[model samples]
Each structure stands twice: as C-alpha cells, then as structure tokens.
Target: MSNTETSPQGSQPDTPGPHSPEPPDAAPKARGLLRSSALVGLMTMLSRVMGLIRDVVVANYFGAGSSADAFFVAFKIPNFLRRLFAEGAFSQAFVPVLSEYRSLKDLAAVKHLVDRVAGSLGLVLIVVTLLGVLGAPVLAAIFAPGFYMNDPLRYGLAVDMLRFTFPYLLLISLTALAGSILNSYERFAVPAFTPVLLNLSLIGAAIWMQPLFQQPVMALAIGVLIAGSAQLLFQLPFLWRIQLLPAPTLGFRDEGVRRILKLMIPALFGVSVSQINLLLDTLLASFLQTGSVSWLYYSDRLAELPLGVFGIAIATVILPSLSRRHAEKSTEHFSRTLDWAMRMVLLIGLPAAMALLVLAEPLIATLFHYGEMADRDVTMAAMSLRAYACGLLAFMLIKVLAPGYFSRQDTKTPVKIGIVAMVVNMVLNLILIWPLAHAGLALATTLSAFLNAGLLLRGLLKEGVFTWQSGWFKWLLQVGVANLAMIGFLLLLAGSAEQWLRFDMWQRVSHMAVLVGGGATVYLLVLLITGMRLRHLRH
Candidate 1:
C-alpha cells in the first residue's frame, strides 16, 4: 500500500537558505542503507551468538535458583537502564542531532557538539551511578519489590551485586555516546561489534572468575564493569580515525547539549516503552516463584536474538539515513525508506518468529539444560519464550517505525503513544498474570508491544508521513505462505520437550542445527517460488 516507486535515494530539494544548510557531501548514500543494515546484522549476530554462550555458561553454573534470580535482578536493573538511557533514549536523541550538525556545520562545530554532549552526559551518569550504588537497597526494593516479602536473603544478595554492577551504567552510557557519533558518520560496524566485548567478558567471568568469588554471581558483576570499560575503550580508536574523538569538556550551558537534554527528557519515555514493560514484568515476576526472574531472563534473551540481529540492525542503519533525509527535507525518500524497512521486517521477522515459536524447547534445552539447569527450568523457560515469540514481529516493527518520528525531531508523538501503551500493559499484566503466572507476564509484554506498534503505525498514517506500499497485500500473502511452510517443516522435525531433554547436549545441538538449516532452506525456496527475488530487497 506504500508508494515504493519513489526511490529511497531521493532527489535533493532546491538549494536551502542560510538557516537550513545543505546536507554534507559525505552523507551515507540512501541506496547503501540495505548493505549497511546487512553489515550491522551480521555483526550483531556474532555478538548475540556470543551472548547466548555467555548465558549458557551462566545457566550451567548458576541455574534457575535464588542466587540466579538475585543476580538477574541485580544485572537487569543496570542492563535495563543501559537500554533505556544509553542505547534507547540517548542514542535516539543524540544521533539525529549529531547527524544534523555534521551535515550542516563544520568539523570543528561537530567536534564541539560531541565534546559538550559527552561532558554533560558523563556528569549526569556519574551522579546517577553514585546514587544507585550508595542506595543499592532502596534501588533493589523499587525494582524488585517482591524480594522484600518473598526472600530476604535474595534481596540482600541483589543489593550487594547492585553496588558492583551499577558503575556499568555510567561506563556503557559513554560507550553509547561514542557509538552514536560513529553511527551518524556511517561507521556502523564498530558500534555494532562493540557488544561482542560484553558477551566475551561475561563468558570469561562465568568460566574462570566464578571460582575466585565466594558468591559466583559477583563474578558476573565484575564482568559487566570490565566489559563496559572495554567496550567504551574499543570505540575510541575508530572515533580518532574519523577525527570525532570527543575531548570531554564541561558544557552544560552549551546550546547542543541543552537541545539533546531537552529532547532526551521526553524521548526517554518515547523510546523505551518496551523496556519499561519488561522491567515491570520483572518487578511483578520477582514476587512469583523464586526462579521466575531467571526463567523470563533466558527466554527474553532468545527472543532478543532475532530482534537484535534484524530489528535493531535495520533501525540503527536507517536512523542516520532518515535523519539525513529529513535534514535535506526529502519527504519522498523518507517515506520510501520506511517502506523498504517495513518490508524487510516482514520478510525476515515473520519467519524468525515462527522459528522461535516452534523450536523454543529445543533452543532452551540445547542452550541451558546442562550442569545445574533442571528439566523443570527448561520447560518453564520455553513457555515464556513462545509467549515472547508471539510478539516478535511487533517488537521488530517498533524498532524501525520509531526512527521515523525521532529523525524528524518529533518526540512528543511517541511519548503520548508510549504512555498509552504502558498503561495498557499494566492493566493487561494484572489481568493476565493471575492465570498465566510468569508466562502471562511475557504474554502481557507481547500484547503490549502490539499496542505500541499499532499506535506508532497509526500515528505515522494519520500524519500522512507513511503510506502502505502498493504491494503490501500480495507481499503479506507470500510471507504468510512461506511462514506456514516453514512452520510445518519445523513442527514435523521438532519433537516433544521431554524428547529434547532426553538428548545429550551434543545430540540436542545437532538436531537443532538440522531443523534450523532445513527450515530456512524451505522458507527461502517457498519465497522464491512465490515470486520474491533479490532485487526486491534493494531501494
């Protein structure tokens, strides 16, 4: 239903007046957005794969018990903040503004903007981190209130770990600042690959550092801090190569920093509704069974694999391109870019979601059912995984659609939509949790994601900023058929959860590999047969 005929590589408007300078000659070419996205996806895939290994290591050592629950709560607090503040809100606000400055101003002005923003952000995060570490008990109570009532020892452990992990908030936010600057410059790979350090660090900590600590969970907290520093340090050389290495200077009064802060205040809620819902789920889940938090954590990680590799990758690449398009006032190109991204989301997202739903048990069994992980834990995690999988497409769609608003400096609209979705999620949580327990928490999150994505799409349509591409119906039909074919193939191959549990780790891994490879092959073949082709992927 969209006007796909208009190229994403849109023609420039007339020469702009002094107030609105022309886009830089070095701005990323629109046609290359897909290639850039592919690069980011591949890099993210590596990171996500390493992250899975990290989780497997943790699960093997800790399993789904009180210590694991405490550690997850401790980690989730900062990890949630990392996404909400660092990657979600900060990057969303900073990148568009940074892109505009780079396109319109001189390199010196761009460098100054980076320095001032970094200084301001660093100062704020320092205060927040200090408060978090000093007030660890109160912070833990606020995030995992059930800890107070259910198990006092778990609450105590979480408080102790929070002090160790809270510093990661400051470190990773700085890393995100660096990543944002690199992304705006169209140097996407460095930021995309930075996550690998975090995963590798955690893996090492779980494997080697655990024996050194009286409490093994403390090892992961140490890993987080080291990874945060390493990830931040890793991006500096790339920034220096591009001559945007920020010289940190106190610039709270600077115009650009002020603009970013102003945008960030609202954009925080606007960009992070999904995270908020998940955090809420964590809070509520903490009051459930002892291992409820750990179950949700593992399942959420599996769902996030596709979302990271595909959804976030597309969003990351497009935000800069969309910002450039908006800077140039190329409305046609903006719409077409959104159109292209939406198609990519469906083309990949549907199959990925289907695969996750069908193979949830196999994945959980292969990845986490070893050492300390029990069969009951595997079964519980799979339920949550399938629930999260149901909302995968919506989650991925939100990733792409949000940038459409953010790039235009329109933060207010998404804030309103986000608020509505949050309220709806809370109401749904109460309604669903009684019946479904931890799995219900996940289902509520997924259902809320649908609400959020729907509102975002509706807003875009109502404002006439996005139109459905003309071939959407036919495209949907093709994707649906392909998904059904893929699902059927998977269901035929995938055995019961008990069957998966009966296998040794090597057997489970081998079976999963075949099912995954064959499912992808069948899905691709069906899509090709239904008239989808490689050229359709391009602008």
Candidate 2:
C-alpha cells in the first residue's frame, strides 16, 4: 500500500534498457510495433489453426445435434465470462496500469502490484468457480432456457458438462493474469502461444478420452478443465524466468489494486460489448432450432480466425506501447501508433472479411462437412458465417479502437457507447430472429459492432487524440483495389458449395489451400503494383 519506491533484488536495473524511453522519431516505434505484432500474429495463427482442428474433431464426433448443442452452451458459458472478465476487461485495465508502474516506479513496486493483484483476482476467481460448479443447472437453464423447457435430455447434459467446464474460468483467468504481466514487459510470445495448449488439450480429449466417457461429450468438458491447468502451469516458469512470479497476497486495500478494480469494473461491460452481443446470440439461438446453436458456433469459429490472428495481434502489441506513450505524454506518438494500427487493420482486415464473405460456404464445407456433420448443417452454418463475416471489419476496428480509450485509462466513454450498442443489438436481434433465424442473430451482432467501432472512433477523433495522417486516401485506394482483386479471384476459383461437399477431405483441403494462397498472392501483388511500399506501413 506504500507509495515508496524500491529497486528489485537482482543486479539488473529497475527499468530495462531495451524498454527505455521512446525514440523521438516515429519510424523506430512503427518498426518495433510491426515486429511485435508479427510475433504475436504468428503465435496466434498457430493457436487458431489448432482451434480449427479441435472444432473439426468435435464436428466429426458430435455433429450439430442435441449433444453438440449442449456442449457448446456449457463450454460457452465459462469461455464467455473468461473473455468478459479475464481477457477482455482485466487485460485492458491491467496492462495500462502495469505499464505506468513499469515506466515510473521501480521493479520492486511492480512486483508488489503483481503479487497483490494475483491474490485478489485469484481469490475472486476461486469463489466464482465454486458458484459456477454448484449452480450449473441454474446456469444451463438461464443460458439455454429452450433446452430446459423443451428438451430435458439436452438440458441435463448441459448441466453435467457445465459442472466440469465451469472451473476453466478460474484456471484460464489466472493464465490471463500471468499473460497480462508478461505482455506488459513486451514478452508477447509466451502469452500468445499459451492458447495453443488449450487447443491441443481439447483435440487430445476428443480423440483419446471420448471413449472413456459414456456420454462421450463429457470428455470435452474434462478437456476444458485440463487445458486451463496446463495453460496456467505453462506460463508460471516463464513468469519465474522474468523474475516477477507473483507471490499472492490479499491486497483489497492496496492503492494499485483499488485502481485496477476501478478501471476493470467499467471495462467489464465497455471492452466486451461484442462478446456480450455474441452471448445474446447464443441465448436467443437456444430457442431457434435443434442445430441453431451449433450452426452459430461453427460459423463464429471461422470468423474468429482472422480476428484473433491479426486484429488481436495488432491490439496486443500496441496496448503496452500506447500505454507507455501515454505515460510519457508523447501525444503525437500515441496518435501515430493508433493510425498505424488502423492502416494495418484495413490492409489485412478488409481482404480477410471479403474472402470470408465470398468463400463462407467453401470454407465451412471444407473444414466441417465430414463425418457426423451433415450437408444441411454445412449450408446453415455458412449462412451464419457470411453474416458474421460482414461484421469482421467492425470487429477488427473495435479491437484497435477500444485501446484508444483504455490506453489512456478512459473507461467511462466506451461503457456509454457500449450500452447504446448493446441495446441496438438486442432490438436488431428481436426484429431479425423471427425472419432470418440464427443468421439474423449473427447479422445483429455485426450491426452492433459497427456502431460500437464507429462511436469509439468518433470519440477519439472528437477529443483530438487521433488525427489522421497524410496518404490515408492513397492507402485506402490501394487497400480497396487489392481487396477487389482478391475477392474477384476467390469468387472465380471457389466452386459451388455442393461441389465442395462432394469432394473428399484431401481434395477439399488442397483446393481450399489454393484459393487461400492464390487470393493472398493476388491481393499483395496488387498492393505492390499500386505502390504501397513497406516504408508506407512504417508510419
């Protein structure tokens, strides 16, 4: 609780030389951001690939049936909260404050903050996990009421799975805490790579442990629990290597803990409005049809790949730098960093969204149209996938834009904007669900995200914190031409959804690989032809 400064125990200085005060020029900062983003993107890409494989395995075994629906809901409940609390709000809040301590205070003070926060956060997660396990049935009933009222078998299965999966919140939340610390020090790889462990654990469970359970789907719930433990354990050694392993101590009265809670409380809603919208989709999807939940799940997973890889990677790399810039009061640098992130978002996000929009059916069919998954399921999932794809740009924008506020520790404005967006999403959901069913719900989320991103961007611009740099018009033109070329190439090459379905797994994989690789090549080549050099991206 003391404000006094103290140095760390090692021979090393409190502030490392590599993370010294920012350079005067924007070029070096831009290069560092690009390098860090690439590293995080690579690690995140690996995790996303593993995640797609895990989903494929689940689809092969469970398909879009009552059990798959049940498992998705049960796993979604904790995973949803994990995003809302741990990764979303907690990370957004913790990183900026940690950066401030790292910048202004000594290493010992940083360690104190880490220890107290760990204890406070860990204790809360333990209690929440207990409540979640005990209240699994009630949670199942609340999250998927249609299952409770109309399908008791599915309802019971959800409850049983929830008990096993709910504890994941505790474990994964702790992992996120450790990750936040490592990321603050610019150790982006360890935290970004940690998710691959979860994907691997779930794949192993589905392949090997499914036969061990009578229900079979129960293995996935066990997998969630195992992955959480492994993810948390995997990061501890890295934390020790950094010499900042948390020694947990209750610090409810600590000043640093109080500040984090203050920022975190509002951020729970502000930073995670998109997630809240998705959860709303699940809540409503529960009542739509037998396969509605699974349809949304499959489609959303495909949409998440680009978002997680590029959108999140860019955001993750920038937040610490943004926080440091803010701490240093480098106003121009902060604005330029945000500008660079937006350009990257457009450069990557636009083409990715367009490709998904054009190839939704082929992508879904190729990845998930095997084994227990049926033709109807593939078609329906593609419909929702396209809808989610429509909003991918907004989703990516929000990832970059929200940090504009959080890096400055300004949480209230985003929360207000989030509330308005959430309300609009609920209204859109009601109006669309009756006509479009599950895809309507996906569309509603898409619309709300655009609103969220728009509002966040407007707030930053109005405050004069983010001024557009020169060449935006030319940059946008290049991106637009590149995306048009990519989309045209993809549409021409991607055959009908039925054709994709008829192909064997190897054929689907090979053809899809060609389409992806070929489309990317065209996009990049067009950009190069349009005179977009690497230096343009360096701000």
Candidate 3:
C-alpha cells in the first residue's frame, strides 16, 4: 500500500501538522480549504463589490425593461459557453490531469503535457469564439426564441450585443485554463483575484462610457468586451511567475494531451448539464415576463458569492491533491481527505445557507435598493434570493463532491447525475412557470440541485469512493443544531427590526446593524458553546 492510500484507493488521510494537537477522534484537516476559501472569499468580496457597482450603473442606465433584459441575454450566451468549456467542464478535467502530471516521477513529460494542452485549448477557444461571433443571431435565437418571435428590434439588438461579447468566451475560457494551472500549484491568490479585474473593468466602462455611446446597451456591450479582456490579460503575469508561460507546441502526439482529451470529452457533457440547466432556467423565465431573467440572474449572483468564494476554492485546491493521493493508491489518505473536505463544506456551507435565507430581504435591501432599483424590485429579488438560498447547500456540496469524481477520473458519473437534474429542472420549469412565475424558476433550480447532489452522494457511497470516520452523522447533527439555535435569534431580531419602518437613512442603518449584530452574536455563541472551535480548520 502506498503511504497515502492504505485505507481505500479513494480515501484521504487526515492532514496533521507537527504543532497541532490530535483530535479526540480521527478527523480530516481542512486548514488548506479554510485558508483557500477565505482568500477566495476576500477576493470575491472585492469582485462582487465591483460587480455591484457595475450593476448599479446598469440598473440606473437600463432598468428591468426590454432593453436591459435583451442585453443580459446577449451577455449570458458567451458566459454560458465560458462556464461550459473553460471554468466548468474544462477545469474539472484539467485539474486532476495536471495534478497527476505534477505527481508523476517524470518531469520532462509533465512540461510537454502542459505546453501542448495549453496550445490546444487556446486554439480551440479562439475558434469557438470566431464561430460564436459569426453565428450570434442563431445562438441568440436558441436562448431567447420568445424574444425574436415577439420583437424584431429586440432580436436584432440581442445579435449586435452578442457580437460584442462573444470574445468573452475566448478570454474567460483561457483564463480558466490559467486559473486551473495556478490552483494546481497551490498559488491560488492570482486566480482568486482575476475576476475582480473583470468587475473593475466593467465598473470603469459603466462610468466612462455612459456618456460615450448613443445607446446605453451599446455601452454595456463594450464594457463586457473590456471586462473579458481584462480578466484574461490579468493572469499572464502569474502564469509567467509559475513558469507556466507556454511556448505553444499544440502537439497532438503527447500521451498526457491525448489522455486529457479523452477525459474532457465525457466531462464536457457533464459540465453542459449544469450550464444547460441555467440556460433552460433562462428560457423558461423569458416566457414569464421581461424582468424574470434579471430577477433570477440577480439572485443567482448573490448565491454564488458563497459558492464561488469557498466552494470553488476548496474544490479547486483539493481535486489535484486528491488526484495525486489516489494515483499513489493511498486509500486511507484519500478517504480522510475527502471526509475533511466534505465536513468543512457542510459546516460552513450550511450556516451560510441559513443566514442567507433568514437575512435575504435585508441583504437585498441594503445592497441593491439604490439607483433605479425600486422597493418592488428589491422584494422580488429578495424573494428569489431566498428561494436560491434553499439550495445553496446543495450547490456547495456539488462543488465539493463533483471534484471527488473528477479526481478519480469518473467524469461520466457527474454527467449522468447532472443530466438527471437538468431533466428534473426542465420538467419543473414547464409545469410551474405559469403558477409561480419567476419564483418557479428559482424553486425548480433548487429542487433540481438537491436531486443532483443526492445522486452524486449516492454514487460515491455505493462505490465506497471515500470512507468517513464513524461520527460523520454526529458531526452533521451538531452543525444542524448550532444552525437551529442561530435561526431562533434571527427570527426574534428580524421581528424587532421590522418595527422601525418609516425612518431616515440612519434609522435604517441602525436597524440593519442591530439585526446583523444580534444574529451574528447568536450564531457565534451557539457554535462556541457547542465546542465547534473551528474543529475542521486543521486541514
């Protein structure tokens, strides 16, 4: 047995530091996840803050009318492909392979693999962008057929805007490749901060270009191009620092390149399930009302704050590590590592979900109530945010668990589960759209996510993918208990805050302060009282 995987081929060992005390029971060390998640969170905060600035400009410049909605549709097309090819599908396949390469005894082959894959993916993304730019109208029709059917003006605008943003597919896809590279090296700060560059670029474009363009939508499209370019170019320095500055051989003969292609083919389909689910959600939302798409978009933006910052950071960091351990046949180490990652995600993700659901209104009201966003928009957005929160835990779990499959090169399993969830989401959308309106989209997404997470977990268990210490359930129960205690205080505090209605800005601020302060106090107290003590932080 290799030292890392003596327990089970897929198991992870507990990470222990020389100075750390032993846990009362065997535990997975999650310090790396914590450090990485927190760093990603801090950086994401900056990005989201900038993103909000960009949105504020958008909302003020183009409210939830046909125009804003049209522009968003154009924007999302390239974005959908970006997630599918670059960040979502490509990275899942790339990370593990790169990790395996890094772990290999042969360094020369590793360098060849990296250069060849970089050259190949770069070429592919460029070609995809060209095709998308050329076929923008056709692509727009697929996503928003209802619009093209109803209004030629809107349809034409969607095509124009799509042309401007199609390059985003190339930039962000390559950025994802760069990020996967940096993440594999454990030098995560650059990739974590890269999106902030995009957000900032948009914010600048929003401010400066508002007066430049004859139409605000044109300005927004230009901003998207600038932002996409910024995100891509920003990662180059870091790539050089890591000596991953590619010479671009584009060699098809490399065994590692061939292996990645073989794996990515299946994983790409798996990734399409998640992205297609969103596109499906958008299509169904379009049939409801003009504003429906934006509402879901805004809520999803909020939910992803936690998911992107923590869930993604951990998933990215651990996949490579897990891949290496499994390759070494370190069964115990693999299971232990998986246990630690799952536990940490559960412990942190559960609380964030609860807090979001509880504080949905205040958060929306605070962050988005300015500019052209009215109180009514806040209410609808908040409602959708709460609904999205219902599945925040599932989203994070999928982020963590999907990596487990990817690490072991089981891309087809996630693809299978993802397709099942997409089917569930599509069916629910068709059935519920008339009844619940946009809210149905949110609810359907949440339900489908749960279905996806459940399937992944079932697959893992059946395969004995990762064994946990016997007290896994007990740990979950403890987290649940602490969150329940936190919820009680939130209910009471929210009720009290509701009393201060007709108030000045300071009064509103004070009310928010009290609600935030009191709820946070209760949450921390409950955790401390229960001896949580960041128990999962060791790894």
Candidate 4:
C-alpha cells in the first residue's frame, strides 16, 4: 500500500512509485504533484478528443431528432448513475478513508479494507443494476415524461435501450473502486486512461455496429456495457501489481467499510450536486421542443472537454494527496496544496472559459454540422454551448473546492451548500427556461455552479482550512488581461455563426483549427508578457 516510486527531483514521502518503499520523512513535493496532475490531464485530454469524435459520429448518423433524443436520454440515465455513485460520492468517501488506512496501517489491513469495500459495493451495485433494468420503463417516464405523453415511440425506445445501459452502473462503479485505490497509491495514469476505452467503444459501435441494429441507437447501449467491463478489467492487473487486489468478503460491519458508508451517505448529495443539476437540466429539456435533449447533450459535451481535462484531472490528483496530508496532520502543506490547485484552476480555467464563449458557434458548426445535423440544430446547440461556457470557471472551481471538504472527511457542509445550489438551479431553470428555451437550462446550471463553488470556498475559509495566499490580486489581474487579449484576438478573426455554417467540412475544420491555435498562442503570449513565468505556475 506504500508508494516506493522516486520523484524526478529525488523522492518525496508522498511521491508515488510502483513497488517502492516508503520513506519516513516523505513530504508532499510540488514536482511530484505537478507530474501526477499532468499525466492525468494528458490522458484525459486524449479521452476528451476521442469523446468529441464519438459525438461527431452520433451527430452524423442520428442528428438532433427523436432518435438522438431517445438515445441521449437513455445513455444519460446510466451515465448519470455512474458519475454520481462511482466518480462522485463513492470516490470522495472511499479515497480519503483508503488513504488513511494506507498511511496509518499496514499492508494487510489496507488489503482487508479493500476486500470488504469491494464486496459490499459490488453486492449493492448488483442489486441497483437489477432494479434499474427492471424499472427501465418507469425510469423513462421519470426522466423523460414528455416522451410518454407526446412521443410514445421515443419513450418505448428509451426504455428498451436503458435495459442495456443500466448494467453499466454496476460495472463502472466497480471500476471506480479499482481506480480509487490506484489513485491512493498515486498511480493516476491507468485510471485517467480508462475513459479512452469508453470513447473508442462508442465510436466503434456507431461506425460498425449501428448498421446491424434494427434501431441503430441500440448499438451504443451495447457498446457502453462492453466498455464498462473493459475498463473494469483493465484496472485488475494494475491492482495486482500494487498487491492490493481484493479478496471479496462481505464487510457490512467492517470498521473501515462502515466508516466509508457513513461518509458516502451525505457525500451522495454533497459531491454530486453538479451532476444532479445537469440531470435536472436533462429532465427539463425533455419537456422542451423535440431535439432539445440532443442539443443540450452536444453543447454540454464541448463544455465538459476542459472541465474533464483540467478540472477533473486536478481534482483526482489532489484528493489522494489531500487525504495523505490530512492523515499526516500536515495542515500547512494541505493549505498550500489547496491554494496551488485553486491558482491552477484560475490560470487554466479562465482562458478555457473565454475561448469556449468566443468560439461556441464556430466550434459547434465545425464539429456537428454534418449529414443528419441541420443548420438549425447547429444554431440551437451553439446557443446552449455558449450558455454552458459561461460557467466553465465555476465548474472547474467546484471540482477542486469540493475535494477540499471531502478530503477532510467533512461531507455535511458541502451537502448544505449543495442543497442551496440545487434550489437556486431549479428556480433559475423555471425563470430562464421560458425565455431562452434549452439554452436557459444550461444558463441555470452555470449560475448554480457559481453558487456551489462560492459556498465551498466560504466553508473552507470559515473552518480555517485554507488561507488566501499573497499576490492574488496581481495574479487575477494577469489572468484578466490575458483573457481580454485572447478575446480581442478571437473577435477580430471571428465570423458570424451563419458564415460558419456556410463552410464545407474541411473548410470549417481548417478555420476552427486556426482560430483555436491562434487564440491559445495569444493567451500564452500575453501571460508571458505580463511577467508570468513557468516557475510561477508551481506552488
């Protein structure tokens, strides 16, 4: 359970090395943290790229119609479950406890804890998956009731597809368990890379298996099940190498397992507020005009690229590190790590948000204006994409800040904040949905994210868990100037959404590439000119 890996700049106590021995005086090192985060970010970047391709394939085939709407809703159910249980509450609760066991106990104890958790989690997931499958029709009504009333065929199809997708919840949750253990060991790459398997499976299904299915979208559901299994299987060897492979045993009463379950109960709500908000968006979108679901799906995917790559990558790396800091009673280092993460979020998230906002229409036009995707669909999706873009920074901030509480085994505070955010989202949804339609749902979600992030930050400060570092004002000024410069550069080169729609596929792709590349170049150049350096990026 100990990390023996040496750091590039000599070994740190918390530096994770496969099959390495622990050093008693090991401290959390900046270089080590950065390395872990970069590795996860790069792998996530690849997965997001593949995910984009998968979306493109789906758009080309199904477009934003009833069929696409049905599949998106079907897929969203299992995926929402996966994120909520596997990556959201479960990971947050499990990792901190697991990290404590590893840091404070022996290898045997750690392995014992793993076995009990795996067994308990596995048993519950199996039961949930069965229920989800059996209740697919009921779920279809609950998630997309508009379909049952106005479009029975789509409703029926969603129910059928969900039966295939529901099993993914069980498989991916177990996969998440494996990934969480690896993260505790500081082996971040394998888990980060696991998502690429899903993207590839969906892409292959869309390209190859879709033609074989009587209803095309069923192929994607099957692909999801296959990907779930592959991702779970892929983590086994890594776990074995680390010698923490579980020998399953029912551990409902196991002390460590009980602790995790206790933590997870509130975390279920605390850690997944964003996902819950998004699910609400999907539910509301269902009652909107047809194609609303698909438009939101596409727009959300674009916003998620940066969120997944930088935001999630940072959150994933920090949780285990923060857990280790907490276990070691290293309050100062913990504060520093949290501060570093927040700074990184601002540095990367600000520019990413600006770029998404500036290039929303061009990006949608370039990516999805294809066979089944009409010009109108492109316009609708871009509208929501911009709406989602508005919350990109807030979304990223929540990813890091929530972990600040979760790593400390403090779940109740976040739950309170989450409830407030959820209420605000619902109210804003009703207020905004009437005027902006599908885009309004996206806007409500964005606004709620700000509320969530702000509350989390306040909680951390009130508890004295984090102290503001000096020079924040100057740092913000630097980021603000760089973003303004990038926005100006993009605006000068930008064309109207209609003009973007007029271009052919190759032309659209080429023009978008130039805009993206040029924007990134300008942002980086402005940062450098403002006296920000590579070293300043490190904590």
Error of 3 at 124 (Å): 1.4
Write down the TM-score for model 3.
0.90
The regions of model 1 sitting more than 4 angstroms off are: 1-31
CA RMSD of all predictions? 4.9, 4.1, 6.3, 2.9
Q: Which candidate number would show the highest lDDT if scored against the true structure?
A: 2
What tens-digit string does per-residue lDDT give for candidate 4 at 141-180?
A: 9999889888899999999999998899999999999999
Quote the positional error of residue 86 for candidate 4 in Å: 1.2
Q: Give the TM-scores of the predictions, in the order they appear.
A: 0.95, 0.96, 0.90, 0.96
Candidate closer to the true structure by TM-score (higher is better), 3 or 4: 4
As for TM-score, the candidate ahead, 1 or 4, is 4
Q: Model 2: per-residue lDDT, tens digit, 397-507?
A: 999999999999999999999999999999999999999999999999999999999999999999999999888999889999988899889989998988998999999
Model 2's alpha-carbon lDDT is 0.90
Residue runs of model 3 more than 4 Å from their true location after superposition: 1-31, 495-510
